[model samples]
Target chain A: MAATRALIRRGARDLRLLAVPQCGIQADMLIGAGCVRGIEAAAVTMGELGGAPRFNAAVKAGAIEIRDSTCPAIHTALQASEKGVPFMPLRGILGTDILAHRPDWKVQDNPFAESGDPIVLLPAIRPDIALFHAPRADRAGNVWIGRRRELVTMAHAAARTLVTVEEIVEDDLLADEATAAGTLPGLYVSGVAEAPMGALPLALTEHYGADTDHLGEYARLARSAEGFAEYLQRHVLAQDVAA
Target chain B: MPVTRTELLIATIARLLEGCGHVAVGASSPIPGAGAFLARALGGDEMRVSVLGSRRHNFFTDGGRELFDCAAQGRMDAFFLGGGQIDGEGNINLVGVGDYPTLDVRWPGSFGSAYLYFLVPRVILFREEHSPRVLVPTVDFVSAPGVSEEGVWRRGGPHALLTGRCLFAFDRAARRFRLESAHPGESAESVAEATGFGYDAADPVPETAAPDRRMLDLIRGRVRDEIAETYPAFAAEVLGTAA
Candidate 1:
């Protein structure tokens, strides 16, 4: 949340964001700050806490473009980008409006099919930067994400991967083959910062669980414009509200 | 003892998972998660259930896209989807109400529905809100169609539509929904009055069976404990027994 505030303070405007598959506070905060010109994500929700108030309000007001998508489509597009492919073919979405709205996405006949099998082809998503929070990072710049492999994909697909970790460990994350399996090598990372409790309202894989009370308060307070402003004033604008 | 409305919904979802070998419940779906667990409990070791958002339930180490990949390969036998608007033709709209980029109402984005709707054979539409507002004659946008055209390479599509008031079985051959049964309080006439879409109905709509004592016992006991891992609030608030 603090990083988002810093970016907003730096005058980031009309930002086009692809929220890997799903997002919560990051998406909402950006929408609330009026920085997002377009958002392409499978879902922008607070999960059990309920709707993302700002994102919903923004969309209803036609403040931004919504490139509505599904989870696999985003992952497949990112996979294409990482693999240095122009596009990748994925199944389903052929008859849906998500595909219809995306003139950029095309339907093509399967080359391997005996007769014909139409498939949806998604363009590669090459983001300018990938930002995430992790539990641990080594001095060698290796970040251990454990089993959350989507971070690795996002890092691999983007031009630069920026990360914040809860702590820096002495042991090289990639020194052991088993640990290396889950570590994002420094080659793909452009920047790293050690911010204790970086992913606060949200949970890190092994570090901590989500601060549900804080999230619940946010969810309750973010429902209205005045309340949202008060929330921003108290959290994002007033102090260093990292969560 | 009389079954609670939520328990009834869970049992209805469980009944839908009768023969499903692998059922994947999406995030924010407490009922379906409970239902999948109920099915697994009754079906013995043959069934595998994966509830998203639970560290203990989902056994995916690959990444966020593992569920999609599993569905694509026909390994996932069942999945649950809901929509802001579900039309007579079985098209679901999670995007929102109103015109394309400029929308009046926006729910969450199409989270994995576009991809999973086609790949998982038994895709159950499980929106609890059954009203004219939700069961529309035509959706504003098709996040994922309940059916797709032939030669579109779809492995599966909508099997049924389950709502708070009724159960609807999709007819892939006919490209429409058939009224299967009505919930306890809802009659055929009441269901029709509440619905905005046109569908064939049985001469005498059967009452949706309530969870029996044994099933309720399981729900109140094991299922409650299991679902708590994913939805603690839901378990504590709704399913918590006053022992």
Candidate 2:
């Protein structure tokens, strides 16, 4: 179908994608679709994003981009874009050249009124769209970040927001009297897609089960250069053929 | 009482981590993980603590649960987080900006700050720097909501800040930051002098505890080794090894 072709083509464009480590299913889909390279994500608990297979392959094949800061790293990138700043400085990675290698990121001098040494500055980040999986949402677009609000920072830093939720509630359910504060109001969000089990490999809190084996498989595939390239060819660029 | 920077950072984290039941730590978070382990060793009743990261087995104990999920679900009591740049309000940045129109500033990646910041009841922030670069009056971008000026998060907001030269805590009632403690070996005057912003100096401040043998051993031996082995950056700092 022409529509399908265009959709695939659009996704194939090279651009930055801020991905959650647990979202391996999306990673598979993206790789299979040839959307992006392997991955360029932050993983605090690397064990959760499958094993060295996927990680190694992505890195070896140059399919993935790695950073030390993790999700907060991606969020900071978006923050720079949203705030129109250059770079923000951080402390955890200071004695190392992690910042230096990331030439795109500038460690700015402290702009505060007083200081002795030079300070690092992190630039603001603004993503095209921040995608997330939610437990509940209202037709009006009000969404509950649920018990795990992993997507909150992404939402704040993203230029636009898209969410796939398990359930849809009444618009009134999003109110303070009805629901507690910390709920994601409707104004900031756009395009609410009802995607059940969307948080696949990534746990969906109390609702769904994670695809652990699948994550492991992905890890295996991404661990080595040859493996990663083969994986991308079969999973991402190859035509979807009947098994 | 004069205290080392490491000790001051640890003590502040220990107090904020006092009542927590379970905490999930990253491989790289030495200060927080060590402090948590010490709290337990010091006869703190909270037993459900674990050191988890990318390589350790069963790191995904809860099926790819967000790192902050345990705290959010009442399963964890406390945790620690770091940032590339921290604002006066305690929001962090870890990503980069581009070269020209928007130079591409690369972020190491985000681990779990998003979920942790929103859900963890007692989220202690630790950064090794105390100058203006590390601590800004206004964050270039807020990767995580510190106070939720617009009311985004319900549970945590950078409760305590442990830095290279000082220690701080948030006044829950006022929702404003207060000086909770000063690191040993340093005076309020030195800390205030080093920091770019101002805090309520009139508030009472506590002294950080010295690092006991047990605590130091665990930190230098257990926590440090694990982190150094897992990440390339920490090998030298934690393990005293060459890359």
Candidate 3:
């Protein structure tokens, strides 16, 4: 709670919650409650985001606004914002349509330190704040990634980060030879919460449901020509300023 | 002699790999891994091959953490996937229940398909069963858009489809799937019978081969063992508890 409060204070107006493609529920909760005005997600377009019932309903009811960010990589790039590097290089997205509007997603000529090969480059991404769900965290904020390495890159790239985990353990968990290394080290993570099943709308391991039915509803609503307009009216338009 | 359903499925995948130049298979993707391994064991070593485990979110490499990064870098020529809902356009929705908020059911969701579908040059889709549940005229959601609304993808579309009883290829010119082949035991009539939409009977139908011993060896030996070591949960889920 302290972490969330501190993050909210730091964000003020400049804060934008950058979520991975998987952070569906967290986005839903924040957007639903009006804590955040807009969201940026990879793979899914803004049009797609507005289609979610919770998001769309919020949009329709005048609760929140939404935006689309392209590719999971771009979202990761934005998470990289804290690193201060201009960009990062990634493969397989080179020739796709995602490259057109994402001017930030540049292709650099490979310096090829080994052989001088001509390969494209991607820009580094660092976000102002990154919120992720994890299995465990220490009081100091070092985290265990376990099998899910979803947000490790973002940790290195983000200016600040907060993790909501299933449990908060001692720093010695990192000391055990059998234990996993610091996926998101205490140095990178500013705050930690023992928030299990925090990754809603999407599954956070076995503890929660993915809320797929809601996603289906969003899909149906998003596909209609006037769905976006209607959704915005119902979810984003009617909210009275929190009195 | 008619090939058993499992054999036929495996054989078709093996056949697809016969002369492919380069390929990458994903974890828990039984068909793709079996096919690629069979192709190599059968003297298609000239084709560069890699079996990438984990999703766009869970990237892994043998060289510890140094070589592994979550993003897919470089050009990927081919990939295979199977999911819950796929439409005529080949758009797939692995993210939800048929409906939202109050969903009928939930799936594991699209781990990497959304990104891989757009990035890979050729994507081969396979499913064990063909019916209204899996094959629909239109997808319920857009986990990955078959044809980007803006025509954004450069090299790949949903290039080809291999189902239990039929084969389909996306005619980029037409921007629709064209019937390419039907399994030996499955006549055009049977394949069409299972599909939600109708197609021309005159479409050229290719013959599907029976799963040979070599293909079985690939599954029992290389693919299954590797999966057991790398992704134990997935192997247990797909191969059953005894396996």
Candidate 4:
């Protein structure tokens, strides 16, 4: 989230943010700050912060293009990209209005199945950059996300991957058999930056829990544009002074 | 015995989840999560629950991908979904209140509701607020349709819609909601007044039953403790359980 705040502060624009629900504070922050032009993901929520106030406001104002999606669709699209496939066939979306709104998605008769049932096919998602914050990273740039394997998929599917970590560990993550399974090889990682408490207000598994009070404050302050700007000024802008 | 509205909803949902082998509850769904936990406790060790954000409750090792894979393979039996606006045809609007691109109100984008609504055998649509505005005649946007075209292969859809006023069972064949029963102190007429959509009601609709002593005991004790691990505030506020 800190990295994303920096990105917004630096005036990154026209970014397409993709992430699963309740785990997209960066996306919500970006949208709220007008740094994002499009979003493709399941949902963007602040967990106990009530909702993504800025993202919700922007959507209502028609300031951003939203590709309303599900977690599986995003995962499948990433999987398709990982496998170098043009599209991936999924079974669950045939009757839903998701297919109706997503003109890019298509329904086709299953040629492989004897039943001749219709299936939904989702185009691969190859993002320009996949950015995330992790608990730790090695000197070699391999990130130790532990059970958070979605980061690996994101790194694999995107053209470039940028990461921020709480600390740069001295040991190689891949050297330990137990940690190797959870490590994302440096090959997929394009850049690494050290940013402690990067996922603050959003919990990093095994590291720390979300700061509910701060998140609740953010939810309250982000209800309107002025409130959101105030939040940005107080939290994001005041960071340097606090540091 | 006197029962709270929150307890009533949880107990009602538990009854709805009678024989589900595996139930998955999303984040910010304390009622459904508690209900699933209660059902699991009552139904024995056969039942399994995967609540997002809980390390103990969630069994997914590969993050978001496993949930979808399980659902597609028909391994998951039940799931819960909510909408900003739900229509007579079982269409849910989670994107916003008004037309697309621009809207009067915007909730979070559709999470995985569209995908899970099609794959899970029994998808319980829930909303604590039951008003004409929420229970609309037609959703402004169709995040997920209740039924599909003839050739579309859909294994699952809406099983029931549970609101603060009553429970409405969805008939996939008719593509309409049928009034099952009204909550205590709520009459069919009162429900009708509150609801914008038309639903078929029984000649003498009975009042929803209160939670049995056993269910209440379980919910207040074990279920509350279990849910607190994921939703501490909800458990604290609703169940009066210390976080």
Q: How many residue pairs clash in each candidate?
A: 0, 65, 42, 0
- Cα-based lDDT at residue A90, candidate 1: 93
Off by over 4 Å in 2: A1-243, B1-8, B44-46, B54-59, B66-69, B97-105, B149-153, B172-175, B202-207, B212-243
Q: Which is the winner by TM-score between candidate 3 and candidate 4?
A: 4
State which candidate has the highest TM-score: 1
Give the TM-score of chain A, superposed on the true chain A, for all candidates in the order listed.
0.95, 0.71, 0.60, 0.95
Give per-residue CA lDDT, model 2, range B86-156, as digits (tens): 76666666533333112233333345664466567777888887787677665544456565533222556
Across A96-165, the per-residue lDDT of candidate 2 in tens digits comes to 2244455655544456635533433556666677777677888788888743444665676677887778
Rounded to one decimal, what is candidate 3's iRMSD?
9.3
Q: How well is each residue in A1-243 modelled by candidate 1, as lDDT tens digits?
A: 446666665657989989889888888988887789999998898877778999998887878888888899999999999999999999888888888788889988899988889888999999998998888899988999999999999999999998988889999888899999989999999988888876777777666888888888889988998888887787677765443
Q: Please give each candidate's TM-score.
A: 0.96, 0.49, 0.57, 0.95
RMSD after Cα superposition, model 1:
1.8
Q: Pick the candidate with the highest lDDT.
A: 1
Best by DockQ: 1
Model 3 chain A, poorest ten-residue lDDT window?
A43-52
Off by over 4 Å in 1: A240-243
Q: Per-residue alpha-carbon lDDT of model 3 for A1-243, expressed as tens digits?
A: 223333333443423565564344344434433467665554222222332444545444444433333345554454445456666555434433334434555655466545433233456655676666777887767788764545676666667877878888766556765554535567778887775544544555546655666555545654443663454345334433221
- B1-243 per-residue lDDT for model 4 (tens digits): 479999999999999999999999987799999999999999985899999878999888886688888998999999999999999988888877767756777677678887888889999999999999999998988888888888777888899999999999999998889998999999989999999999898869989989999998998889999998988888888898553
Give the per-residue lDDT of model 4 (tens digit) for A1-243: 878778777878888777743344567778887788888767777655556777877777778887778778899999999999999988776655567788999888888888878788899999888888888899999999888788888899999999999999999999989999989999999998888888888888888988878887778888888988898999887677322
Give me candidate 2's TM-score against the actual structure.
Answer: 0.49
